[model samples]
Target: MSEVQFACSTEETHQVGKPQAPSFTGPFTTEGGLTAITLSSPSEMDQWIGEWIELAQQTEFCNAFYEPTFFQAAVKNLASQEDWQVVLIKEDAEDKLIGFFPFVRGRGPARLSELSLWKSKLSFLTSPLIRSGSEQQVFKLLLKHLRTMQPRVDLVELPMTLAEGRVHQELHRLIRDNLLTTYHYDHYSRAILTEGHDYDELLTENIGRHHFREYRRQLRRMNNLGQVEFRTNEDPEYGECWADWFLELELKSWKGEGGSALKQDPQQEEFFRELVTSRTRAGGVEMLGMFLDGEPVAMLCTLVSQKGCFEYKIAFDQEYKKYSPGMLVQLHKMQRFLESKRSPWVDSCAVPNHPMINRLWSERRSIEHMVVSLGRPWANIVLGAMPLLRSLKRTFRKPKR
Candidate 1:
């Protein structure tokens, strides 16, 4: 095999007005008699990434779940705080960009070289930018790169969209077949708005059944307390106050409970703070507070984009739990969305099956996982053993329906 060297100068490679041009030039012949190439800069990979997303839209699992700008923003934010690297892969002769993976350096209590540098923030869902016909091939190519790059990473954590079945399943199969070390975390959930074929029709369908009756019931019940109202400030100037109040409610809700919000990690807090400010500027942040007797009892912070409204955060006074203030706040938010006709869907975000989400939204969303490793003998042995370990662990537990 012939070897070539490519320089790693960012400014020289990422010149203005040529976003699609390759930064570095190299070549490799694959076992399938295919050639592989690499691009060095994120901007250079944009054209192919855009094409992949367009093709991804036609796939069955496609949803407005991931916006390119959101990913870009997240990448920028994560990169700012940590040592990270972005890898772009392409098929050799075809000149088609196949995948992009943004990874960070591994740090923390876990042993170094035992895991891949993973993202601390939960924003980017790992979906490959692959053409329909080349999904498996593209994934295999990415695995080859990851394996070659593994010494720099430890464990790899790629969260797949549950709706995208093939990639995740293929990844699992590959891990077992190759014998790689793996762990699975079933965290996060989403609520999908369903009811109509179109946005307006969906809202119409939700009116009496979802929004009206429930919201009216809550209002009537709270009316005896004095007054119940939902409020929002669209002006950007009000964002800081909104964030402060929302954070207070969130922290209070988890005051005694051992939950994520109670951890009070500065990094996560900074991420949220930046997220609120940035999204607000883009008109993507919607802060909704519910007032009972003219006092705030519950609040929700939703992210609004062209795709839909995401229920990112919600909290209600524990004292008001008897009245189901959280549920009441959600209903009002949904009703407000319906009234404004601003967005087509409202995602409950990723959470396990909760009663509120299951009862309110008719549509279901999924979370996916992917494992990519270098096809090394040792890696294969470890990865291949995971299924057996899982089976053995399951055998010791009580059976469930």
Candidate 2:
């Protein structure tokens, strides 16, 4: 731990019972002469985290998973002790913070660890939380520092970063122009939407109006079974209740039976509860539900940050499968987004060519498992095998219907 003071928007706060890292204040110099600090404890920046998130949101490259709340959840429920590290990319000439990157080093494909950005299997759409315009510069310095830094990191592994995002794009460019030792692990597509003038207009332009009309007709028929109603939690007071409803609803679906639902996993459930509770107060979480005669039938959980909204989980009663309650709720949710204009965009984190969301969100955002191996002796082994592994994965995937 190092000792230093930062001129941040919020003064440091120490919360009892909350996890705390030893006070560490060390000045690290980037090869470019930029100042930064790396801390093992996330609590070190608790006071400044809120302001950091606010600033990150202003940039076009904000990632919800890299937010402090997400990191806190990961540290408490997902990661074991000594698995994660927070590196603060300091502002060039000031005591303030410019960017924050939280990375967890783990073994790569070759059973060797050079990759530090691999946190857990839970995080999707991975990327460093770098200052928007400094992605290239920061990595250059960090990679250089890694060569001599106490814990030798061999590579920065970002497995599922959106191809179009500035983080991925800039890093890709670094490989191209700077001759960095980077490798392409895999490339795949996902559904993403860029909100346009009106939701109606976008729907009409994307999914034909006639087809959308048919979905509405199906919903009207579902009304015959019961009084179909769509609802979302807009009040923090009802967050716990809504979360309970969602978890219970999820239990009635295949996910629970298969032991994959959040409630089925104690750690994951706690992670969601703790993180979503905070996000709800910050207006960054939404619990959308569909009801039948006042009874919950289906629900969708969404997490929002300044960057965009991500549809985290969707669940519905299998008894209402014929009514397509889940898909119906999905449409209603999109309609609500259109009406409320709450988010500028939404990411349906579905796999490529998903049966439902892919058709709805016509806009495609490609994502890839990208690895930048350090120029170490064994690094080339991981780099060389990535393309072959990607091909095998593609070959084994179920063919699109």
Q: Give the top-scoring candidate (lDDT).
A: 2
Model 1: per-residue Cα lDDT at residue 189: 51
Cα lDDT tens digits, model 2, 287-316, are 889999988999998888656888888999
Q: Quote model 1's TM-score.
A: 0.66
lDDT of 1 by residue, 1-401 (tens): 33244443234545488454334543332435343444333444465555545544443333322334445545545445544445555554544455445555554112334333234355534554444455566566655655454244445656554544675566566667766655454535556773234433454464545664655676687778877777886788777677777666777675425456622656556656766776677677788898877678898887775545667778877877767788778777765776677666677775667767666666766664534335444544555666677789889988787
Q: List pairs with backbone clashes in candidate 2.
A: 1-24, 2-24, 2-25, 3-25, 114-155
lDDT of each: 0.57, 0.72
Q: Which candidate ranks first by TM-score, i.e. highest?
A: 2
Q: Compared to the true structure, candidate 2 yields what TM-score?
A: 0.84
How many backbone collisions does model 1 have?
A: 26
Candidate 1 segments whose C-alpha is farther than 4 A from its true place: 1-5, 8-83, 89-99, 105-117, 121-141, 150-156, 165-190, 195-215, 255-263, 338-344, 370-373, 396-401
Q: Judge candidate 1 at residue 38 and give its lDDT.
A: 44
